[model samples]
Target: MDALVLFAALFVSVAVGFALGRLSRRHLQSQYPKDYALNYYKGLSYLFNEQPDSAIDAFIGSLEVNSDTLETHLALGNMLRRRGEVTKAIKIHQNLLARPGLNTRQQHESQLELARDYIKSGLLDRAEALLLELVKISSAYKQAALEHLIEIYQDENEWDNAISAASQLDGKHYRPKSGLGLKQLQAHFACEQAQEDMAQRNFSKARTHLQEALGFDSDSARASLLFARLEIHQSRFREALDHLHKIPQQDADYLIEALDMICECYEKIGEPKALQKYLRSLLAEYPSNSLVIKIAERLRWLENDYVAADFIAEQLKQRPSIRTLNRLVELHLPHSEGRAKENLQLLKQLVDRVIEEKPSYCCNKCGFTGNSLHWLCPGCKTWGSVRPIRGVAGE
Candidate 1:
């Protein structure tokens, strides 16, 4: 089916070329070029012989690019690029740009296509130069050029440039179809920069970047997480708790990422009771396997194994989970004797294997599963989409 579509598109382009040549012949008082007619037949013969490359070359040779055939040429180049023939696409678009009679729009369009070819071929530096030029001189292509520039910067890990391009693209009127608005994209970029600063132990610089990230997107969970890390690094436990507490409100899907940090902050402040209160609050609002386990561990530490086991059993009635069940068995295993003890031991081992085999995190957008959380989903590259998996077998 794809081959047929390619053939049909090529045939239409050739037909259009033939029609244009006929029209030119009538106006110029000259016979239509015999070479054009011969090449058209040669292209058809190549197509019939299953020599698509030769067919494409012959079709391109037959077409005389002018105002009339410029769009056809551009369309052919774009099709070739999409077909993974980047080198041929580059030649076609380059040939168009080299023509002297092209108007500004045509020139910009050709430059944009050639830049795309460069990007596809991994020549990002060349693509960046052409896209930057287009962003400066071509109002029609400015947004498109900036979008491509952002992609290049992201691929190159140049987050500052990505943020700058995203800022230019984030007009009041613009909204992306991915539902990941430019403001959110900019926020992620800023968070990326903050991460770099934090790695270098530049706490002040990291804080400034996190502040800018939150300014771009007040609901950025990644920014909150980073801020918590920065504050904790400085031994500002209270400040860290403040940032960690904001995560559930900013994006509850990422609340798991802040849970350990919240516990550490409360511990550092010498407030186990406060930690217990906060965990209960979170469990009441957003119950999950992790919260259940955390609360049960606290119960065991403060009271007895019986209390933790009973708590897990009651919670299991409300929300059945393998993780809670496993914990329940572990709490009771020591108290059992003979067959009962052996049975609980076997059950625990089985549940442990099952839990280990299950993925802990999953991408909400693409269903990519892994054991670790990814702020940007590896499958879809969507920011904040990957989260701790929830349900019977996960947290």
Candidate 2:
């Protein structure tokens, strides 16, 4: 943030100085206005000291509205917005817009700056109105205004508007709409729309949106997960199995997330034998501890405690884990007589206490760790960056 303020101050100074120099191109004023020059120096002093808010006030107070100074005010407003001083930025821009000497181009620039100020101040509706006008004008500001319109719509959950603005920026009407940088983002928006449909119990609409999401980005794990949920809702467990299986192929790192739901689908369809075979293949390939613990559970339930305990114990020798060790102790507890049972219980309690403090998921983007999965990392707002932890104490 401090860096941003410094850059903003530098940009404002350069832009103002250039615009005023252009105005003096003909008349060539020999001396600077004493008051204005002194205030400009004060601004430089404050900004250099890392007091950018004070610098913005000094610079803004020094400038007057005129054909020569329109760019200067715009630059000051932009700098204030960058410094996170939205109210002062708005006041400066609004006052500039109200002035009489600005040309059509200068007026549009002022509106654009004010729109950005509203955006910074969380006044989305005001920003939206100004940006829409700029878009309709189709001036040099059209591209920038349309981009901000998309941002406003995204924040307001207006997917249809976002898609429209994104398409325009993508050159869909003019060309193929391929190079605007939002194909993957559009997929997430479609997924968001699918989620909204699912919440309203509109399964058919949800399916349509999910299909659209996949069309936008075939590698979207959230789309696959939501599709699985939709299938599960309609009791199409076998169909759900197909979608859940695709997630690992799309992004292998997210395979751990699909495991539990995959198990449920097979269980729902009365395919425990087939499920075990599938899990075995996955475990052999991935060796994820979740899969290991899952296979041990089936062994304990279908065969005997000793078989399951021995299975986990053998796996632990190769790849030790607190989870597997805890399950191993639980399996041994049922069969052991008094003292052995007591010792196993104590060991289980200790392992439980240790595992309880471990986080389930961690973000590779920002190193944020938490106990539950987040499709969009809370720390960095990055999609698909968080995943289940994998180590001796996790998986």
Candidate 3:
């Protein structure tokens, strides 16, 4: 059925060509047998006979694309690419580039289209080279080429190259749709390099990269989070506590991320009681269900189940979350018996399923949801867009 529609569309193309020639055939047919009207008629006949190869040849050979019809070709190539026909789009754009009479601007436009075709074809190296040339040759596509180059560098996991390309967008009039600003994206690239160093256990190098990242964007809570983790790896509990504490100063929305790490730091220093007091102070200031949940768990570990359960129940009354509700069920499951035990079991399973199915992170820019957070949103490729899902169903 789709093939039939495609054939109909092809017939329409030939019909348009025939109509165009009809306006000028009397003057053109006497002078040239290669007249557009005659070629269109021949292509239509081949198509009617179901000889697609011959029909394609007739169509390609007929169109004498010039500056006057440049937009028509560009639009057709763009439509082909949009239809996932990258090879066909490449053919059209390549033909335009090979022409000798195009002006400099038209050549640049063709280069941009061909470069996009190369990108869609997964020819990253070819696309990168062509885009770099386009950046140097024409401001007409500078922003678009730079963005595509950044994407290519990211896909290659070349963090340094990505950072350099992103930095170039600072004053080049390339505005990010997420409003991340070039500086913030560069910071994310630095953080990515730092994460790589951390994975290799190169602590000092990771610290250096993280410091640079913080310098680039001081409001980056992700940088502070990494700094805290590095301190924890070194067993510098005091430093780690300080670093974790700084997350709130940067962005209070991310304070929940540091809760467990903060508790760990305090526990390492033999200060559970102090940790409890600090968390209470934070709860007073922040008013978040995540902080409340952490304090309840700390109480459960230090005091008794009743104390923890009561605290969580009271907090749930004020501000509730799926995470806290799951914890609540667990707190009473061990003590309940008979019908109460069975009821608790069912509730626990239901709540667990709910929490598992729900996404933990969401991209504010594009509304993409995931269980894990990403510094750059996979949907939008915008830095710092994925954030914790907050409210009753989440953090």
Best by lDDT: 1
Per-residue lDDT for 289-344 in model 3, tens only? 78888888888888999999999999999887888988888999999999999999
TM-score, candidate number 1: 0.92
| TM-score list, all predictions | 0.92, 0.79, 0.87
Q: Please give the CA lDDT of all the candidate structures.
A: 0.88, 0.80, 0.82
Give the RMSD in angstroms, all C-alphas superposed, for model 2. Answer: 4.8
lDDT of 2 by residue, 1-395 (tens): 76665646564664566457546753645554667656767877776777766776667656656777776677767866887878988988988888787788888989999999999999999999999999988577888898788778867879878778876674443222223236666787788899999899999999999999899888887889889989998999988998988887787667777887888999999989999999898887788788888999898888988889899989999998999888888888878989888898899999999999998889887899999887657786565678889898888
Residue pairs clashing in model 2 are none
Give the best candidate by TM-score. Answer: 1
lDDT of 1 by residue, 158-179 (tens): 9999988888884765655447
Q: Can you give the lDDT of residue 299 in candidate 3?
A: 87
In terms of TM-score, how similar is model 3 to the real structure?
0.87
- What ranges in model 2 sit over 4 Å off? 1-58, 64-79, 95-110, 138-146, 171-181, 337-343
Error of 1 at 208 (Å): 1.5
Q: Which candidate order results from sorting by TM-score in descending order?
A: 1, 3, 2
